[model samples]
Target: MLAPFLIMLREGLEAALIVGIIASYLRQTGRQAWLPAIWVGVFLAIALSLFAGAGLQMASAQFPQKAQELFEAVIALVAVAVLVGMVFWMRRAARSIRAELHASVDAALHGGAATWGLIGMVFLAVAREGLESVFFLLAIFQQSQDGAAPIGAALGVLVAIGAGWGIYAGALRLDLKRFFRWTGIFILFVAAGLFASAIKALHEAGLWNALLDPVYDLSGVLPESSPLGTVLGGLLGYRDAPSLGEFLGWAGFLAVTLPLFLRPSAPMTQAVGQK
Candidate 1:
């Protein structure tokens, strides 16, 4: 639940920011006539995302038990990949996102009578974010056997949308850099858990046998059904008795991935003669 919520919040905020920038730019440039087209694009993108997610869910349900496990494993792996990429990509790109959006807006304005192209661009951009959210939510939902996860995810998204609106309306100011930084770190741990979960799924499907057996049993001492255990499990993929493969997979991912993320990017240097 926590994982899905945070993932959706971050993704939704990103899409909202993009759309807000485009809309603001058009208004400022006296091109507000195109506002309707932009909205049309947003609705289309959202519809497409819903369709794709429903399609995948239905298709997966049609598979046999073993095949479904394999499918879930594959989806989890893909979600991890996409999640990691999104974190790093945003880390590197966030600083310059405004400039990029401005350039895109400028290009759109220059391409006369290509209103549909602008719509397509917005659709593709928002849809990319939406599709990624869909894949990630599916993976998280699979891991969260209990039913609380969906509620958490919905809450996160609703709050994020409110935040986005606040920011746009100048009613709230967010330190986006810090927001992403903290969330990125949190997401890294989530990704590590997903990696472990993926391995467990694959093992369940009989696809991988290495380290197939449990290494230690902690359930008696700290049962996963307990409140603390449940929180830990939801936040960091805690298992009462993890297999050797799962332990190695989680530890290995954290050991390698966390450090690189912790490392600082280039310092934010300003021009010597700047105001």
Candidate 2:
């Protein structure tokens, strides 16, 4: 539940931030006529996400047990890839995103493209984020059994929307740089868990089973189904009794990914999204 919530919060906030930036730019440039098109793009992106999520969920249901496990493993891997890519892309783009968006909008409107071009630009921006959210949500949803997970995710999105609006209205201030950095770090850890979980799924599907032995057993002391266990499991990818392969995969992923993510980059000379 917590995992899905944070995932949606971060991803949804990113989409909201992009939408807000575009909308504000349009208003400032006296291009308010294109605002309706922006909304249209947002709606389409959301519709696409919903349809894709539903289609994938329904299609996966028909598979046999081993096939289902394999499918799950594949989905988790894809989600991780998308998540990691978005984090890096955003990190690199944060400083120039606004100017790049403004330039894109100008080109779209002036290149004999008009409203459709602007609409397409907005669509791509929001849709990319929307689809990423969809992938992560689907992967996490499959691993969850309780209803709270969905509720948490929905709430997270709602809050993200509110936060975006507040930022746009100048009623709130957020340190998005630090926010994104910390969240990126946290999410990489979560992705590490997913990496390990993917390996477990592959084993279940009879694809890989080298380190089948359990590293440790803690179920008697702290079952994965317990209240604390559930929260930890949702947030940190906790497993009461994990296999050796799972541990190594989890550790190896973090070992390689976290440092690269945390390494300092050249500081932005200009604040792109400042109020």
Candidate 3:
């Protein structure tokens, strides 16, 4: 529940910020008439995302058990890759995103087909985030069996919508740099877990035969079914009895990725919607 919630919250918040920034830009520039196009793009992108997610889920249901496990592993790997790319991109782009969007808006408005240009701009922006969310949710849902995950994801989206509105309205002042930085770290952890799970899934699918030994067996003391274990498992891919391959995959991912993520970079001079 918590894992899905946080992931969705971050993804939704990103989309909201993007739409809000564009909307704010339009309103401020006396282009309020073009605002409806943004909504159109947003709704369309959302519909596509929903459709894609449903289609994938249905398709996976018909697969045989081993095939399904392999599918799950593939999805997890894709999610991890997407997530890692997103985190790093945002880290580098955060300071310049506001300027980039404004430039995009200008370019679209100046184009011969202004309406379609704006629509396409907004659609691509929102769809990128929406698709990212879809993959993350699919990976999370495949691992979780209870009813709480969906509810958590829904709540996260709602909260993100509200937050976006507040920020656009200037009713809230959030340190977006800090927010994204911490969440980026959190996402790295989640991606590491996903990578580990993907390894386990591959083994289950009879694809990988190496590292069959148990790295640690604490199933009796802290079983995955236990409340704490479940939470840990969902958040950090905690396995009470993780095989050697799983442990190495998880640790190796963080070992290589975390340092690069935390390394020093150029300073950010502006927020997402600065004038």
User: After best superposition, candidate 2 residue 120: deviation in angstroms?
Assistant: 0.5
lDDT of 2 by residue, 84-197 (tens): 888888788887888998898889889786888988888988899888887888778776665698998998899999999987777989899898898888788778777888
Go through the candidates in order and give each one's C-alpha lDDT: 0.86, 0.86, 0.91
Report the lDDT of model 2 for residue 31.
82
What is candidate 2's CA lDDT for residue 210?
Answer: 94
Tens digits of per-residue lDDT for model 3 on 144-187?
A: 66568899999999999999999899898889888998998889
| Candidate 3 TM-score over all chains jointly | 0.95
For model 3, the stretches where C-alpha displacement exceeds 4 angstroms are 267-275
**Candidate 1: which stretches are off by over 4 Å?**
267-275
- Candidate 1 C-alpha error for residue 192, in Å: 1.0
Q: Is candidate 1 or candidate 2 better by TM-score?
A: 2
Strongest candidate by lDDT: 3
Each prediction's TM-score against the native? 0.93, 0.95, 0.95
Rank ordering of all candidates by TM-score, starting from the highest = 3, 2, 1
Angstrom error of the Cα, residue 81, model 2: value is 0.8
Give the range where candidate 2 is weakest over 10 consecutive residues by summed lDDT.
138-147
Q: Write down the worst ten-residue block by lDDT for model 1.
A: 105-114
